[model samples]
Target chain A: MPLYLIGLGLTPDSISLKAINIIKNCSKVFLDAYTSILVSYEEMTKLMTEVLNRNDLIQADRTLVERDAGQILNPAKDSDVAFLVVGDALCATTHSDLYLRAVQEGIQVKVLHNASIINAVAGTGLEIYKFGRTISVPFFEEKWKPVSFITKTIENFQMGMHSLLLMDIKTKELDWKLYMRGIERYQNPRYMSCAVCCQQFVDVLNTDNDADLSVETKQDFEEIRIHAAKAGFSVDSKCVACMRVGTDDQKFIYCSIGEMAKLTEHMGAPLHSLVVLGNIVSDMEQEMLNLWKL
Target chain B: MPLYLIGLGLTPDSISLKAINIIKNCSKVFLDAYTSILVSYEEMTKLMTEVLNRNDLIQADRTLVERDAGQILNPAKDSDVAFLVVGDALCATTHSDLYLRAVQEGIQVKVLHNASIINAVAGTGLEIYKFGRTISVPFFEEKWKPVSFITKTIENFQMGMHSLLLMDIKTKELDWKLYMRGIERYQNPRYMSCAVCCQQFVDVLNTDNDADLSVETKQDFEEIRIHAAKAGFSVDSKCVACMRVGTDDQKFIYCSIGEMAKLTEHMGAPLHSLVVLGNIVSDMEQEMLNLWKL
Candidate 1:
C-alpha cells in the first residue's frame, strides 16, 4: 500500500500517462481541492473520470487535509491511494509535509512531478534564472494588511532579478462552511486579478515606509514596468499575453500602474500572476519586453 | 502547421498523456538533446517509441536548435511538429527564443509544460520561496574559468536565501564533432558530481576574491551546510536522499567540503543538483536538517 502524490498538470489534457495509469489502478482517488484552482475543474473531473472509468472521486477539502491527515494515510496503509494536485506536488509546502508524514508513518509515497506556475512563468518571455524569491499577494484586510512582499520585491529589484507574485484564491473554506450548514449557498470563488493587485501595490507603496527609501528610489519604482500574465497554461498559443505596465501611460503602449489600478476590465479568468521586471541584461529580453510595449 | 514544445518531465514515466497523444499525431518528433538530460535516455526513448509506435525520432542537437532552429520550424509550416524537452519548455532561454521565432514565422505553436528541477527541488525539504537566483557549476577550463556563480551563491547567502547550483552536462557537442570527423570516439558523457563541484567550490573560494569581505564573512561561508541530491526523479520513492555537507565532518552527518573534495564515490546517474543552504528560518526546516545531522 503506497500513497501516490500525482500532479494533474494545468489543463484537463495535461494529465501525464503515468498519472493516468496510477489513477486507474488506485483503490481510492482524492483531489486536493484547496491549494490552487485549475483552469477548468469540471473538464478535469470529466476527463479523469472518463479516462479512469471510475466514479466516487472524493474532493479532499482543506480541513480534511490539514486536520484529518490520518483519513488519507490510514487508507493508504491498506490500499493504493492517489492524491492528485493541480500543479506539481511539492510546489505547496503543505504537500511536502504530507509526504514527510506518510514517510514517517511507514507509508510508502511516490511523487509524480508536473508543471507548476513557478516554472511556467517562463512563458512570459522573462528569463527564469533572473527570477528571485516568489511572493503571494493576499486580499488585504483593514486590520491585518501585510506589505512585506514589497520589501522582498525591492530586494529582488536591487539584485537585478524579477519577482513573481502569485495572486490569492479563496475557495474551499467558504464552500465547506456552506455545505456543513446544508444551505444552497453558492458564493463565486474570488481570484485576485492584476487590476486588484496593482491597486494593492500602489496602496502599500503609499502607506508603507518601512524600507526607508529616498525620493529617487520611489521615482525608480514608479518607472519600473510590471508584467501581468493570464492563463499561462493555455495550450491554444505557445506564448501568453503579458501586459507591461509602467508609471507614465504615454511612455508605454500598455496601461500604467495608475491606469491598471483603476482598470474595470479583467484580464479574463482566474490564476493570474504579476512579474515586476528588474535590470534587463540581455538584448533578447529587452526585445521581448519591447514587443509587449504599448 | 503547428509546433508543440512538450516537456518530458523528470523520469521516463513522467511524460504526460497529452505529450504522448501529441507525439503520436505529430508528423515529426524531435527531442532537444542538449539543454538537460532525463534520468535514462534509453528508457525514455523505449517508453516513448513503444507508446507512440514510432521509431523515426530525430535528436535536435544544440546546433540544430540554437543555430539552425529553422530546420525544426520549417517542417511545421504544413505539418504538426513535436519538439520535446527534458524539463519545461521555457526553463531554458533557448526554448523561449525558439517559441518567439516560431511565432515570428507565422507558425502556430503550443507549449505543454511539465516538471522542471526548479520546482522539483522543493522535495529537498528546503522552502522554495527562500531560494534566490539559480547558478550552474561548469567544468572549469584552463583558459576560461568562470567563478561568477560563486559570487551569486554568496549573494544568496547574504540574503538568507538558498542557492540551487545546476550541475553541467556535456554530451552532444563531442559526439557530433566526433561523428563529423568520421572518428569512432566513445567518450562517456561527463556529469559534474557533487564531489567535483565541492572541489571546484573550494578551489574558487581559495583563488577568487571578487567579493571583498572581512574574515567573518569567510568564516560564515565555511559554517554553511550544503545539500547534494541525486536521482531526484526516481518513482520508487517520493523522497530523494539529500546529503548535508558542512565545514567540519562533526558538524553534520554527511561529508564536509574537504571530505567531499577528495571523495571517490559517485552519486549515480546523469542529473544531479546542489543546494547551498542559507540561514535556516523555521523550526521545521531546522528539524528536517537535523535529521541529516551526524
Candidate 2:
C-alpha cells in the first residue's frame, strides 16, 4: 500500500490548493481522528467531498488507529490507502508511528505536511523559540483536578515569553458499541472552554504571590486578549473576540482576561484553543496584526 | 495603510495557497527578520519571485524593521503594507508593537498565520507540551561565548520534559546592508549545525555533572535524534536522518550524530533549526521516533 499521511492545519481555510489536489489524486483515504482533529470538521468534510467527489474515505478513530495501522501499513496487501491526519502529517508523533507501521508492513508510506497550530501561533505575535512550554488546559476533574499548567504559564511570562494555551476537545464520534480501552462509555461531554481556562488562571494567581507576575484582578482581565480558534482546517466560523487583539475587527490584539471571559458569544463550536498574550507591545509586526478594521 | 503579517513555518514550501494568494495581493511587504529567517537567501528570494512575481518586497532586518517601521507608520502610511513574518504570525510578541504603531497611525493590519517549528518539533516524536523553556544556540564565538540555554534545557529534562534547541541565523540581506545592527559576523559563516549543536550540548554538559545526564560518549551521540527541519511552510523539506520519520528514505541514515547529524546535505537551506530531543518521549509516538534508522 502506498499510504500518504496528509495534515490539515489550524483553520478550514488554512489548507492549500496543493493539499486539495493531493487528496483528490489519492486512491483511498484513512483519516486518523485521535492524535488531533481538524480545525474545521464539517467544513473540511465539505471540502473533501467537493475535492474527492466521494464520501467513503475511512474516518479511522483512535480504536481503529491504535489497533491496526497495519491496514495502512500493508494497504496494497489488499488495497492502497491514503492516511489523512488532522493538522500537519507529522505534528503529532502518532502519525509517524502509523507511517512507520506501514513501512514495517512493507507499505509504501509518504508524507504531505500542512500547517498546524505549532506554527500558527506565530499569528499571536509570540516568538516560537521564546515560548517557554505549551500546556493544554483540559477540562478539569472536579476533585482530582490538575492545574499545574498555571505554574508553567507564570514561568513563561517571567522569562519574557508568550504562552499558547490549547483548549481540550469534546466530541460524540466514539463507537460506544465497541469494547476497547474501557473507553466505550468514555465520552466526556465537555471540552475546555476559554471561560474555564480564564477562571482557572485567575484562581491560580489569586492563590499565589505573583502580583508582578500575575493578572489576578478582574480589571487585569480587561487588558487580556483571548482568542479561541476552532479545530478543523476548513472552518470559517472562527470567532475572534477580546479587544486586546485589535482596535475593532483587527486580526490580533491584546485583550484582558475579563474581556475574554465574556467572549462566549464570539466563540462558537468545537476545537477551540486560546492564546493568552502578554507584553507583545514591541513587535514591529504589530503594524500587521491589527489590520482590516473599519 | 494596511500591514499583513504572514508566517512561513519550517518547510520552504510549508505555506498555504491561501497565504500565497493573500501575499500576491499585497503591494509591498516589510518582513521581520529577527525571530526566524526563511529557508535561505536564495530560497526566500525565489519564494518571493514565484509568489508575488516581484522582488521588491522590503526584507526588514531587525534594524530596518525597528527603524524603517516608523516610516511605514508615517509617510508610507497610505500604502497597503505587508509585514511578512517567519513562523506563525503570533508566535512572537515582538511584532505586536508594530501592529500597535500602525494602529496609532490609523493604519490597518492583518495577520496570515502559518506553521512554525514550535509545533513542527512534535513531528520529532516529542510531546508538544512536554517541552521546557525554549532557547537558541548561537554560532559559537571566540570570547563572547555563552551557553546559559543549556541550564534551562537541563532543568526541563530534570523535570521530565523536552527541549527545543533553535539554530541561529546570520543574515546579510538588503535590509541588513542598509540597517546594520553590526553584530559580529561569523568567522566561518557557519550556522550552528547539528554536529555543532550536539558538540555544544556536550560542551555545556561537560562544564557540570552530566554523568547521569551525560550524553557525551559517542554511544550517547548515537542515541540522540537531532532534527534538521528545512524549508518550512507548505512545501517544507524534512529529512529525519538519525531515524526514519513516518516514512523510509533509507538514503538518510548513519551515525553522523546517530545519523541525526546529516547537517550539510539534509538541512535543505540556511535558516534551518535543530532540536535536541529530551527524555519525555511520548511512548505512543516513540514507536515512530525509534524507527529513525539510528
Candidate 3:
C-alpha cells in the first residue's frame, strides 16, 4: 500500500484515468486545499462523491498539512493513502516536506503528475523554451512590500528570457490576530491580479536604489529616468495579462505594463498570471502576441 | 465546429476525461505522431479502437501536418476534429504554426492541456521557480556538432538557476538520402539519453574557445581549465539525470557531471532529461538529490 500523491489538473475533468482509479482504490483520500484551490471545497466534494462516487475524501488545510501531516501519512504505512493536489503534484507550492517525511518513515511513495500553469502558460503561444526563472508576486501589504520579484524580472529581461510571474493566492488562511486570540477564524481568500502585479512593478521602477541615496536631488524626474533605464523595463514595456489560463473562459490581454495597471477592475477572476516580454521576441511570437493586443 | 488540440500526457492513461469525451465525439481524430510519440502506433490504435471504441483515428505524420495541414483543418470547419499530441499540447513542440493557420482560415480552435516533462521534472524536488530558460540537446552529427546548449547551461549556472535540458527525439524522421531520390521512407525513431547529453557537456568543457586559437599550445589542459572556469562549470558540477519523468518507471540519478558522462550505456529508455544544478541549491533540494545519488 503505497502513498499516492496525485495531481488533479486545472479543470475538474482534467484528472486522468490513472489518478481516478487510484482515488477509487485508496483507503483514504486527502485533498490539499490550502496551497491552492482548483474549485471550492463544496465543488470538489461534489466531484468526488457525485462524480468519482467515492466518499473517502478528506479536506487538508494548511495547518493540517503543514503542522499535522501525520493525519494523512500515518495511514499509508498499512493502507493506501491518496494525497490529491491541484495542478501537477510538485509544480506549484511543493509538498516536498511531506514527501521527505514519507521517505523517512519508509513509506512506499508514488506520484501521479498532471498539467500545471507552469506548463499551461505555453497556451499563450509563447514558447516554454524561452521562459526564464518563474517569479511569484505576492499581494503587497502596507508595510511589508517586497520588490525582489520585480528585480528578478528585470534580470530575466536583461538576459533576453521571458518571465512568467505567477500571481499569489491566499485561501483558508488563519488571521494572525484571530489566531493569537485563540479564535480559529479563516480570512477571506485573495488572489493577486495582473493589475496589482503591474502596479507593483511600476512602483519598483519609480523608486531609486539605496545606492543612489547620496546623489543630490534624488527625487528628480530626470534622475528617476536614468535609474529606471538601469532597471531594464519601463511603464511602456510589453506584458501579457492572463486570466484563468487552461480554462474555457480564459482571457489574455497584451498591453504596456502601465496600461495593465488600469485593468484592475475588469480582468476577471482568480489565478491571473503576467508575462514580461523579453528583448528576444521573434516575428512569430510578435504575431501571436498581436492576437490578444488591446 | 472547432479544431481541438488535445494533449495525451506522458502515459497512455494520462488522457483526461474531457479529452476522451471530445475524442469520442470528434468526426475526425488525428494523432500527431511525428513531433513525438507516447506509445507505439499499434498500442495507440488499440487504445482508441478497443478502449475508446472509436475507429476515426487518423495518423498525422510530419508531411500531413506541416505540409498538408489543410487536411486536418478543412474538416474542422464543418465538423469536430481533435489533434492529439503526446505530453502537454503546446509545451514540447510549438503547434503554433498549425494553430495560426486554423485561425487564419477562420476555424475555431480549442486546446486541452495535460502534463508534460516541462512541469513533471519538479518531481526531482528542485523548485520549479528556480529553473531558467530550457535548453534542447540535439543528436550531434560528425560534421554538424553544436555546443550552444553548453554555453546556455553555463549561463543558467552563473545565474544560480537550474537548467532543464530537454533531450531531443527523432520520431518518423525522413531519411533525407532516400527522400531526395524520391523514396518516401522514415528512419527509425531515436530518443536522446542523459548519458549522451552529459558526455557532450564534458566534451564542451574539455575544449578551449575559438578566441584561444591565437595562443600557442591552445590544446593544453591548463588552458582548457581556465576556459572551463570562465565558462562557469566543470566535471565536478552536480546534475540530475532523469529518465521517463511523470511515469511509473521514472528514474532519477544525481551525480557529478563527469560521473554522469560515464553512464553511457545504462541510463535506460527514451524521453530522458538532464538538470544542471545551480550554486543556490537549498538543503531540502540536496536531501532530495541524496535519495537518488549514485
Q: What C-alpha RMSD separates each model from the true structure? A: 9.1, 10.6, 3.8
Among the numbered candidates, top TM-score falls to 3
- TM per model? 0.78, 0.68, 0.91
lDDT of 1 by residue, B33-149 (tens): 775455345666688678876777788887898899988999899899998887787785446678778989999777777888788776555688888998887887544556566
Candidate 1: CAPRI quality band: acceptable
TM-score (C-alpha, index-matched) for candidate 2: 0.68
Query: Candidate 2 chain B — worst ten consecutive residues by lDDT sum?
Result: B228-237
* Best of the candidates, DockQ: 3
Clashes of 2: 85
Cα error, candidate 1, residue B255 (Å) = 6.1
| Per-model DockQ against the true two-chain complex | 0.40, 0.32, 0.80
Q: Which stretches of candidate 3 lie over 4 Å from their true place?
A: A172-184, A207-228, B172-187, B207-227
- Please provide, for model 3 over A1-294, each residue's C-alpha lDDT reduced to its tens digit, 9 standing for 90 to 100: 889988888887888877878888788888888644665557667778866786667889888988998998899999999998888888876688998999999998898888888998888888899999999888766455666676678788877889999988877689999899999999998888999999877665665443444344334434445645986578888999988888888889999998998888879887899999887898888888888987
Worst lDDT run of 10 residues, candidate 1 chain A, spans A244-253
Where is the poorest 10-residue window by lDDT in model 3 chain B? B212-221
> Sorted on TM-score, highest at the top, how do the candidates line up?
3, 1, 2
Name the Cα RMSD for model 2: 10.6
- Model 2 chain A weakest lDDT span, ten residues long: A228-237
